[model samples]
Target: MNRDAAPWREDFRGGSREAEDRLFRAMAQAISPRPAARPDAAPVGTDRADRRLFHAKTAVGITDAALMVDRALPAGLVVGHFRPGAILPAAIRFSNASAIPQADGVPDMRGLAMRLAIPAGGPHDFVLANFPTALARNAEQFLALAMAAAGDWETRLARLASRIGLWESRRILAHLKASLKLCPSLAHEHFWSASPYLWGSRPVRFELRPVAGEPPPPILPAPGDNALRIEFASRIARRSVTYRLALQHYCDERRTPIEDAAVDWRPRAARPIEIATLVIPRQDISGREGRWALEQIDRLRFNPWNAPEDFRPLGSLNRLRRFFYAAGDQ
Candidate 1:
């Protein structure tokens, strides 16, 4: 929306033109209509791990939010040490998936965007969700899915009419209809990169596992209570969770295309997880120190395209993102 600050338009040339056009079109359409809402499915299985759902209603006014990457880190876990490379100081921000800053304890898959300053090499960045895999694979698939989900009110009415017309004649039609759902509220879910990326010569993927503990205590509303703010402040004060950063690598030659986000790479050999610890220290969210830290860290941006050649993001989604994200920011 900030035309002058638009980085995509200024840098648009070479391979990214088509993606840029598609993104703009999608944004335009998304703003024009009331999309249909899908019915929630009945809870499926008894397995709590698979059936648990997290949703958070965020508070207003915070434009963006971030997690301090190193504040709770386990000692000696290195940052920026690629094979044949040296360590570098890096900063990261974690936010809710919707891009708006929300109260901390809301159920959502935390969003993490990291920026690593590479001395003598370009900075490496990433945009990630907490899941182990993604719902869609490529830019085209993602675009189509998003468009279908954003169908206007008339589109929804037409669909309903069609359903009614075939009601008596076709029971299968009812079962076959696909429902469109909005992106899950990030607070209550975990996200994944869903695509493979390079880490040195090995191909790898990342996941964010929440710290081991029961969920934070529920917030009680009072005369002046802001539930999310209070929960986040208290949790920061108590320092409740600890998450481990882990990586999975591909050893099979068949996984080399590295250009499709949809295909699951079968591992010829699997390696044990190398752990990196993340810890958050206690602090007052509104205090000067907390505010300054959050401002400096949260405002930082992470672009997956900003990596050394050996570790570059290589899939269709990554390529598409290289353009669209830049355009959106621009």
Candidate 2:
């Protein structure tokens, strides 16, 4: 990792230290979510209503005979079931981040949720990500913002400004400006977990980026409500998609805080060390196998907290997620 001074290190105190553990749990429970229909149920987010989801229970594993390079990770950071060379069965779900479902052409945060069953038949490892590698707000801040969206957009922004400050409001607006922009295709877009996590015991973050030198996808029809999903599924039907799963360690507290969910580490610290790959093969969702897969995806929960002990999610955002995620269990 780069030894150069990271100017953002001073802000690295937001992750675990942001709140007392119990307090975060209390805050999550205070929301008073309805009892989940299932043991592992949880909400996708504060933003609910008029939402649309396009899902596929595709398999995931490391690339076939691909090179495995380690970044000198400590044993604690090797994450038991997710070591550099491990591979397992996995499923994925894709959706748009909006309280009200909008057209795929509409600008909105895009999401990718994946669930990988452990080798020993333990709890599935779930990793949720956004197209942008960074988040605009932290735990409490984001919850407040999403809640406000239930009302009018103007009201949401104004209320958020009053709660978090005008400067933050502007910063968030700018961040979303880029984050919500339409992507060429879901298969072509890169995804990030955004929040940091414990790589075993060490602090680090992970992301899945498209591998280079692949054939460029063909252009599709004009913008429509479910355009992204349609195009993604169509492309997959023709060929498989692959992404590199890489991890970046925390060099220093200031450079890479473990508690803050809003801070973007590795911006100046160092590049991610490629550890594994994710390959999603083509499938016809209209067929019997596809229908069975979709049913499975809908029945289970997809939360970052679903991982094993070594891969536990870190930071305040994760803490806040404790209750809401379980609430979605069904």
Candidate 3:
């Protein structure tokens, strides 16, 4: 295999890869740490899945707009209750995904998880990721990668594996390629819901594509690691920025596979349909306000499974994720 190229890079050009559910589950059972409480006692906790620490995180208002589903879709185990022209209010939080909470230049992933803030009901949390696609193929691979990052002997072993030709090393390489992105400003980066989620009954994916503004010039000096955060703060303080909330429906098992999270939708032919518009208004997040924002969100659970009955997250990776971050009373 070419050292610079991945053998499975073109794998998604075919159809969906069949998942080994039992294999993933068994591995999870063996490696999954025993929670402080029993699985039934408390399914989920305030503890994050992997990205355990963050900064420059804040909530922004989502306009009360209609989410027009382009096609006829169902609810219940899907984008539940969401249809063409259904009015809703939403909010988003921007954060750095670092378990050890390192500096900005340290190669890591950033995230933007949104949630519907309804007046009389619960919220549907949405994790819009910075990566175009996930670094692992299935639940088993995903778990291995998380364990490696979770810190401890596992992390050491994972790093050692990367130096050798091991399966875990492949995942590390994928993580490096997918997560180490050029992010000078939030307005320039396109965020994705890398894993597949139920769009009504059909399995589909979501993306937050930047609709305006060009990337900061490459010749600009590196203003330190928190440059993206500083730019984001400055952007919001000056004016609102927009990102097209779009969806990609399943076309085939290969091109739009439900199980594999490692491949992006190849050939950017049809731009995804714009379902809703995310307008992030300018605001201040310094001093007490920033601290308060962090405190409030840090206490709340922000898993992708924090959605409604209609929008059930699918695939093995999500299943394992749900296992790690369920929201039972603690």
Candidate 4:
């Protein structure tokens, strides 16, 4: 084990896993009163159709991609499916991080969930967002936020203030506001894991960045509700989309705490190093293969824990996510 990771390991071992699980389960329940059901086959835009409490917006696109590890990667950085020159099949899903489907022009967080299929075990999944940091620092705070999210905007703010105090609630709201960006295209945005994960015994963060030198597509002056989807599909139809898969190694507990995810570990203590390439070839997502891919995504659970032991997620929030995702899967 990496000696530098001892503090986080000890902290994780000291926590009450059972208690955390119960808390997350309660969070899941409070977020969505409806019992968890199988992924619905209903079409997008169906009112309150999605069973997920968060990121309920239907996927814009689900397509086949390829992850090619850099051939010149250092031997020490090569582990699991990170072998040099290896090309792994990947499933990529793009969507809005909103329970209510809204116009693409509206400010909201974006999501990218990628699942890479390896030969050894279950597929490894990376659930990422455009934001580099999360609003809540721990499971308890996240539960409070979840409870607040179950209501309308006013109700959410009032509930949050009541649960976590006025000042803290306002601070979280400010974070939320800043995080909700209005990116013109999903293909042009950068996505981050936002939480630390084990990278061959070392805690690291992951990111997906658009390949350099590619000009972003033009944006609509007045975007429609499905504007983002339209822009992404138009881009895919014209040419392939490529991203550099990068990693940010942990510096220390102070700068890269494994437990606090709200901290952005960039321009401070760590720098991102490109390790692999992700290519989404030009394709017609409305075709038969595209339809099949979309169906598969609907039935899938894009949990960060759907990974090998070496890549297990770290932090209290991630631990809570395990149970929260499990509860949603029920």
Which residue ranges in model 4 land beyond 4 Å of their true spot? 3-7, 10-14, 26-49, 219-222
lDDT of 2 by residue, 137-251 (tens): 4567756664565467668878888878889888877777877766567766677778777664566677878888656754653476657656666766787777777777777
Runs of candidate 1 exceeding 4 Å displacement:
1-80, 83-90, 99-109, 119-122, 149-191, 213-229, 251-272
Each model's TM-score? 0.55, 0.77, 0.72, 0.87
**By the lDDT metric, which is better: model 2 or model 4?**
4
Q: Candidate 3: worst 10 consecutive residues by lDDT?
A: 5-14
lDDT of 2: 0.59
Q: Which window of 10 residues has the lowest lDDT sum in candidate 2?
A: 56-65
Clashes of 1: 20
Task: Please give the lDDT score for candidate 4.
Answer: 0.76
The best candidate by TM-score is 4
What does candidate 1's lDDT look like per residue over 85-194, in tens digits? 23334454555443333444433345555555546655566556655444445555444444444467456434433433334213322322321112222223333555
1 or 4, which is superior by lDDT? Answer: 4
TM-score of model 1 vs. true structure:
0.55
Rank order (by TM-score, best first): 4, 2, 3, 1
Candidate 4, 156-257: lDDT as tens digits: 888888888998888888888898878788778899999899988888899999998666568542368777767777778888889999999887888888
Candidate that would win on lDDT? 4
